[model samples]
Structure formats: C-alpha cells, structure tokens
Target: MSEAEASHRAIARWTSRVIPAILAGVAGYGTYVVVDRICIKFLYQERNQPAAIIVILILYFLFLLLSLWSYIKTIWTINTDTGLVPLTRTPPSRASSKKQSRRKKEGDIESQPYAASAAPDSDPNSPGLERFYTKEVFICESDGRPKWCPDCCNWKPDRAHHSSELGRCVLKMDHYCPWVGGMVSETSFKFFCQFTFWCALYCAVALATSAYSLAEIIHEGRPMDGHIIAAVAISAFFGLFTFSMTLTSWRYIFLNVTNIDMLKKAWVYQLAIQVPRGTPSTDKYTTITYPLPEFSSPQSPAAGVNGHATGPTSPVPAQENVSSARDQMATKTFAVVRTEHEENPWDLGWRRNWEEVMGTNIMDWLFPIRKSPCARHDVVESEYAMGTLVNTIKERYGLDKLPREGSGGIEMRDVPRESRRSHRSQRS
Candidate 1:
C-alpha cells in the first residue's frame, strides 16, 4: 500500500481500537461507583434487604445498556458517514489533464492543479451548463503541496491535502481527533452533541441513585457531597461547549462557504455562456451566470461586484442533457454573481460606516476580553477599511470616489453627464 493509504489504515485502526477501550474504562468506573454505593451503603443487609437489592440491580443493568447504545452510535457516526475521500478519488478535468501531459513532455513537475475551465462559449438555455460551477474552485495557497497520490497524479483542492494518515479528504476537516476515534465534520458535531448529552444523562442518573446512599453516609458521619458536586459541574461545562460548537458550525453551513475562504479573502470565477445584452431567458434555458469586472484591484477586498445568488424559480427536471455546442456558443453571455464567501461591506476599511451600522462599540461586543494587541481598535479598523482606500472598488459599488471630509484624498474630475450615462447603460 502507498504511504497515504497506510496512514489512513493506521488512523482507522487506532480510532476503532482506542475508543472502545476508553468506553470500556468509563463503563468500568460506572460499575464501581454503582456497586460501592448500592452494596456497601444503600443495601441495609436486614431480612428484607435482598429483595430491594435485586430490584436496584435490574434498574442499574438497564441504565448501563442505554448508555452503551448511545456511546456505540456516536462512535459509528464518527467512523463512517463523513464524505471524506483520498486525493486519488478526485478526478481531474480534461483541460487540467492535457496541461499536465504537455508539461510532462517538457520535463516539468508532473502534478496538475485542481481546477476546471469555464466554457466561454456555451448555451444559456442548455440544461448541462451547471458543470461550470465546479470550475470556479481554486486551491488556497496557505495550504501546502498535497501529497502525490498515484490515483490522482495531480494536486488536490485547498484544505484537502492527502492525509497519509487518514487516506481521505476530510470534509469540514480540522484535524484527526483521536479522542473520538476519527475525523471531524457535521457527523462528528452531532456525535459530540450526543456524547455530551449522554455524559450529562449518566451523571444525573448516577447522582440521583447515590443521593439516598450519600444521605445515609452523612447520617453515619461521612461527607461525600463534594464528589457529586464535581461530577455535576463537569457535566455542565462539557454540555455548554458541545452546544456552542454545533451552532457555530450551522452558521458556516448556511453561508455555503468554509472557514478558510473567510480568512483568505479570495473569490472563485468561472467562464460561462455569453448572451446579447437585454435578452430575457428563464433559468431552464439560462445557463449559469458568471461575472467579469473591467478591472479588479489586488489590494481591496470590497472593490469587486457583489454577484447575485441563482436558483430555479420553477422545479428542475432530472436527466436533462444538452450538447448543441454551436447554439450554446452563440447565444449566451456572462454576468457575475458573488459567492457567499465575499467580504461584507463592513469588512472593508470603512470604520465610520461600520461604526454607524454596527454601532459605536461594536468591536467590544464582537470580541470580548481584548487579549491580543493585534486585535486592538486601530488594527481592526484598518483591516476592515482596506478596500475603501481603493477608488476602483468604491466606484464599482457606486459609492463616493473620495471621502467628503478627508483632506488627504483625490480630487474629482468632471466628465459629461451624457458619457457617464452611456457607460452606465453599457454595464447594464
């Protein structure tokens, strides 16, 4: 097996093996606690004590089974159901493959980047046009070179390098968390949620059963209240942490973007069908729309078009196919729609505007404790306003070219209103 595959097996094996052992340890502890409390403290050992002991034993066994079921289900979800795959599983686009072949002939590096081309000549009315959506994806530079997989023979997507350890491209991957016995994602989020709930549940059940025993112990002059309190406190803390993570993850899912996309400030673009301006087409006949700015400023995050979202107003049909390259190439035109990953207007260095919208003390509320000097007011304000410093981004968004009150700013040059109207009309 390849190193990557071997790593994956190791991960799977450790997870499958180590996790069960931990669960067994927890079960053993629970048994010791239950037996000590019931047999030594709670059971009276009088003539009628044996009957009460039998009833308690039956209930304890039932509770243990329920706890085991929840634990097993959580482990099962973590080990499977997450849509991870090896780089070998990722298929390369034909264009990427051709590029690699040509490069190899010239004795260049053998690997190809993970991206597909935009079909500039495409039919807007064709059903097969959505493949262009995948074409926009680009590997983020922050992620290092992906391990070369014999199956893929190309570079993998961003945040998706081969884990010689896991042998799969983990979805919503952070790191391979061994404690839970596998990779992390929505599935693991749910698993953690259930695990926390089960832990709290067991804690409550244990405490309640032990309460009467503890009362007797106190009557007999032993203080065990501290142990019960400690267990309860730990349960509360774990529950809160697990619940908060679930909500944050849900926000990322709704945005249709990943955490990496937010930090890097990048946009995905694809070539699409071209059409004549001022033509109306239903989404069925309408191909995926793409945006092209006249000029995009490298320095500004806010200086790009805010592309609109797309979806069918009507129900879509399955098994639809179109291959009329001639008709597709002729009638369609490209337009832009911003991905959900686009930086918000507030993210640009528009501090006054941000303070106005989010309120004067927004930073304090958003980031409490103020632990890092880098996260100070001036730094936050500057990074947020960086895009507004550029004139191109401001003009594209139809904002004022220069700040009305600033002294160190550019002067506005006048153009004929008629020429401005013509330019605006052309854009439409």
Candidate 2:
C-alpha cells in the first residue's frame, strides 16, 4: 500500500524472473563450452576422437534434456487441492430458531471446511470426525475440532501449512525454493526433485568432460581459455548445490514427511479427550499405564488407525458410553501423546513412503515421467497409517483400560517433562 512497499513488490517480481534467467544463462554457457570448445574443437578436431566425442555429447544432451524438461514442468505445475470446501448441505429448519436463540458461543464446535452434514439425531453444530489422514483431517482442536486457517478461511488440510510468500495454504507444503521458481507443494514436489537430480547429473557430466578436456590441453602444453575454466567452476558449484538438494528432497520423500513438518517437529500423535466444564480437577483424569489397542482394520471409520479410516463408512463406533444424558454432555479437549521416542505416523516404511511420493516404478523414481499415486488420491483414500509408537502405546493398555468414551473424563494427557519432574520432586 505504501510507496516503499509497492516498490519492494516490483523489485521482488523482477528478481524472480532474473534468477531463473541467470540460471538458464549459466547452464547455456556450460553447454556451449562442453559441445563447442571441448567436443568439437578439442576432442573431434585436435585429438580426432569422434567416438569419444559422440559418447560424451550423447550423455551430455540426455541429462540436459531431462533437466530442462523437469525444470519447465516444475515451474508450470499447479496443485489441484487449492480451493474452499463450500457448505455441502443446507441448514435445517431449526437453523433459524438456533440462530435467533443462540449467540456465537465460546467452545462451539468448529465447523469443518468440508464437514459433511450431521445426521438427524446428531448435533447439527458438531461436524463429523475427520476420518482421512493423508490430506483432509477431522480432528483439529484438542477437543476434536478441525483446524481453521484464519487467513484462508477454511479448514487447513492435514499437513497443509500456510506459506507466507505465497499467502495461501499449501497442502503438504514445503519451502519456497528459488531455483524451482515457486513453493514446492504436493504437485510440483516430484518435478522439483527430478529437476534437481537430473540437473546434478548434468553438472557432473559437464564438470567431468570440461576437466578432462582441460587436462588434455595441459598435457599438450596448450594455453587455458577462460571459457573452459568458467565451465568447470560453474559445473562444480551447481553440482554440489543440486546434489545437496536432491539428497534432502529424497530423504524427506522416503520418510513420508515434508520440509515444513520436519521444521515444526509436528510428528507427534494429536490425540483428543472429553471433559466437562467448570474447571474439572486433574484428579478426574486417569493415567492408564498402557495405551489402548491399535484400532484394527475392521473398526469404524471414526476410530481410524492413524487417522485413516480402516473400514467402510459407518456410524461412530459404540465405544464405552455413559447411560445418562448428564454424563454425555462432556466437552472434548486435546492431548498430545508423546513418548521418549521419535515416531512419524505418516511413515509407512521407507519403501512404501517412497512410493507414496514418487510412485512404484524405477522410471518414476528417476524421472518425472508420471504423476505419483498420492497425487490421484489426495482427497480421502490415501492413508496416514499407524506407526510403531502408536502401536506400542495401544498394546500397553487394552481398550478396557480407557475411560468411558462419553463420560467427559480425560483419558490421556501428556504432561510436560518439567511438570513431571517437579511433581516427582514434591513427592520425594
């Protein structure tokens, strides 16, 4: 809005274009030196090694082609998951009465950005539990509310983080990479990885050939040229940079985590519990020594394994419930389940995690030839499967050990380490 701010915006837009051009110019110059100075002038004419020149040039062009294709695709890539989830069902007859009778209440159930309509007997204000874990999430607040993005005015999808640069919520959002010329979200992620990988290979080839050609000139007492020297230096730098990027990208891909998630260290299970109002004492909370059973594959969708629905859509499972209505009017609150271990629920083992991001085939891993399997099912089917830590906790305590489901009792709460230590000191 201010003059300085407007100028800054203009400068940013110009730099975005300039950076890509500079990169392209550097790569172009490297290509020229490799093809013209090294292959044609030195290898073909002076040394008269047509076969060697042919072989080197063939490899050079292949890597160059792959790098360029991936770069272009990544720049132009658009994600499919960017949009609002409009109200799917109309509000019922009591909507007017409720609107008139009830003011905006604190701790009101958070409406989901894509919450399906409530069933007839269900509280209209309460949206269904988020079943899918891959992208869409139902459990948001500790009290089982979906996360609402104030800026985006929608329920932020699972792992969807708002990018400050892009000013939008990006699903499985990664950092904004200048080399790729955009924020690497779910769509452009694969192409970005491929571009870095192919470009690394491209630089390696250029560096090797240019260094070899320079060696030949040195052996023959030929003077060095600036062009060949620049090629080697450029290739070496780019090679290191791209190689590092490739390693980081593939590592996260293999682990089934994103750069943002890794930065946040938000790999813990965001579990929930129910409690009544009026400051219920912590005494009502019970610490079960062990966790409940890992909800098996045949369980209700709401009681999904690692937030992924294991079975067909069914009504919320008949868990331990209170018979009286007074006990049922409980407020749900959030708890974080943490162990003295690092566990990523999203990790489906290294191989399966790789398949989730890059697809199954070797070609798919090496090149951006096809969209990944995760791309198709970003909505519901793809899973955020249960992990070892969760299973460990579940195995510790049987379901019978947990509190009655609707009793408004805190079933699980991970007290901070400091609190636990202080409590132990007092006891001592």
Candidate 3:
C-alpha cells in the first residue's frame, strides 16, 4: 500500500479501537473521582448517610455498565454488518455448485413477479412490496439502476455507501463518529442512539448530584473543594453536549433520514430521478423538486441544475445532454413544464418510516436489546416494485398515468400557485 493508505489505516485503527478504550478509561477515572470526592467524602463521611451512598454508587455503576455495553455492541454490529470483519470461506466443490444450482432453480420456480400497475393503495395483497419498498424501487444515478461498488466488488444495497474510513460499504451510514470511534450504520444505529441517551442521562445525573453537594457545602459555610468543582465542570460540559447530540439523533430518527442523507441531498435527488436507458423519449421525466423545510437550510442546488440559490431551478445543459434524439425528445416533452416540490420517495409517512427502522414493537423502539433488519433486503430486485413507497407516490400524483397523444407529456397537477407567482415576480 501507499504511504497515504498506510497512514489512513493507522488512523482508522486508533480511532475505531484505541479512542474507545481511552474514553472508557477516562469514564472509569471520572467515576472513581466522583465516588471518592463527592459521594464518600461529602455525602457519606460528613452527612453520615452510608445506605444512600451505597444505593447511589450502585446506580452509577449500573449506568456505566449499560453505557459501556451499548458502546461495544454498536461498534461490533457496525463492523459485522459493514463487512469490515472478513468471513472465511472454503473453495466451492462440484457438489456445492450442483446444490447451489438446484436451490436457484427451486427459488425461481417459487417466485412470481408482481404487476407494474399494482400498488399498495389498489392491491390488498401487496404487503411484501411495501415491506421491501425502499430497496426495490430506488435507482442509482450512475446507470439508472442499482450500482455496483467497485471497491467492495459487490452490488451496493439501497442506502449503502462506501466508507473510506472503514474500507467497506456500510448500510444506511449516518456518519463516522470520532467520539464513538466508528461508523454509525443501520445495524448499530439503535445502539448508538441508546448510547447517546444513556450518556446524557448519566452526565445529567452526575451534574445534578455534584451541584447539590457543592450547594450544600456553600450553605454550610464550607470551602469549595477543587475535586467537586472539577467534577461539576466536566459533568456539566458532557451533559449538555450529549443531550444536544441525543436531540439531533432523535430528530433524524423521527424523520427516517440519516446525517449522510441530510448532507447529500443533491446526490439523493440525482439518484431518484435517473431515467432508465431505452425509456421512450416522448415520456416526460417529470422531477418534482420539493421546497426545503423551514428547519433545513436551503443551501444546495438540484443535480444538473445551476443557480446561486439552493432552491430548485431550471436544468442547465450538460455534456450528458448531447444532441441525441432522446435528449431532443426529452427537451420537447417537457417544453411546458410545471415545477412542483418533490417529496422524498423513501419517506413512507413518519410512522411507517420509524417502524421500518426501529421495528413495530413499542418495547423494541424504546430498547436496544434486539437488532432491527435493514430497510431494503431485496437489493438485487428489478427497478420498481408494485407496492413500494416510490410506486405509492407515483400513483398518488398520477405520475405513472400515460400521457395523451397530442399533449406535450406527463402533466403534474400538484404545482403550487405560490411558486408560480414568485416566478412571475422574479421575472418582473
């Protein structure tokens, strides 16, 4: 490997392994300091409350155990699911090959394709489609199909991205957290969320207890202990930081979006609207651009579009838009286009989306004991699934409705009148 690659590997090892160890050591030291200085020195020895001190010590240890377990589990799950831990396999023999072929034949015989026109709204028996919605329908922009990661040497699953840090493709990767020293991925997301929650809770409790002890000392006209002051400062800082992180993580969980998704909005939009090869030129590829919500900053432009502002704007001519019949036809097809805000195809309503990641069980939603499956399992399936979120959106907006022969192309009726007025005002 090159010098740069070796350096990166060293950094990854330190971050993913050494940093976590260091954090654990720091936490242990902090616990010792708190128990010695505050709990024993102030609460028990001075106040003569041995029983209360024991109970408090027990609770602190319990929180520490939970936090440590969650952190370790999160890292392990991420590594396992992201293919960071390589599995050993023996060379396939003729017998194994024959068995695989036989299984493939049996599988093909049992499977049946759903009709393109069928949707969850129209079809009563389309639960499978809805279950596997995100994976089957979402297409990559590179070739207007599910993409193969050259580095991983495998078909990239829906929402999976190649992580340079981990040297693998991670499913639904939120981010590589330096604090945790690992990638927060689909498999580990729940545990990571729990870890943050626990961290915040533990810190808050410590801060509260330390503050109370300090306040009592001051009221009794005692000198402020340096150890107590240090404990308070550390607890306060970490408590606020962890609490803010927890809130941010929960916000993403509720939205069913990832930190990476938020950052790569333009890329996601580009992937969603990629037109398949051999699609008829007369078929208008109507891309609905949604206004960025008030919560999110409008700072990124749509793919292939040029504008100073982040809002959706007209498509600029690119090298890809050559003077081919298909390109010419696409231009003509959308000659009288009506721009509307595009909804996220992956958003299957907040409730369904949350359930998709966190599981349907309320207990499972609250706890991180059980692992939740990835959103889209059938990554190798065809372009579109019958009852998927994408299909549902298309059906609701009449996007799949055939264009009239004399009409320019697909007519979108959800165009906002306010947007048009704004356009007019800008022109004037």
- Which prediction has the highest TM-score against the true structure? 2
Tens-place lDDT digits, model 3, residues 1-428: 23454577678767777777877876876797679888888888899888878877777777777777787777777666643322122223445434433543454311111111110122212222222222324443221222334333333545666665765666677888777767887777888888888888788767777888889999999998877787789888888988998888888876777887776424333233312222232333433222212233323223212212222334446664334333233322111121234445466566666666677887776566777544344334332122254555444444456444433322343244545787899999
Candidate 1's C-alpha runs over 4 A off are: 1-16, 39-67, 86-164, 186-188, 207-219, 223-428
Q: What lDDT is obtained when candidate 1 is compared to the true structure?
A: 0.39
**Per-residue alpha-carbon lDDT of model 2 for 1-428, expressed as tens digits?**
22443464466556666788999999888888998998988888888999998889899999999999998878777333322233224333444323312321322222222222321212213232233221211224322334544433444545666554554567677777666666777777888889999999999999999998878778888898789989889999999999999999999988888877676533444433221222222322222111111232222323322342111122345573222332223233222233333466566788888887788888888887776666554434223343454455434433224444443333343235545787899999
lDDT of 2 at 148: 47
Candidate rank order under TM-score = 2, 3, 1
What's the lDDT for candidate 2? 0.57
User: How does model 1 score by TM-score?
Assistant: 0.41
How many residue pairs clash in each candidate at the backbone level?
25, 7, 4
Q: Report, for every candidate in turn, its global Cα lDDT versus the true structure.
A: 0.39, 0.57, 0.54
Candidate 3: segments with Cα more than 4 A from true spot: 50-55, 83-136, 148-150, 265-281, 286-342, 375-399, 402-428
> What's each prediction's TM-score?
0.41, 0.65, 0.62
Find the 10 residues in a row with the least total lDDT in model 2: 284-293
lDDT of 1 by residue, 13-129 (tens): 677678769757755765665665455445754223777666666666655665565456556766665535333224455565455445445642312332223111122322212
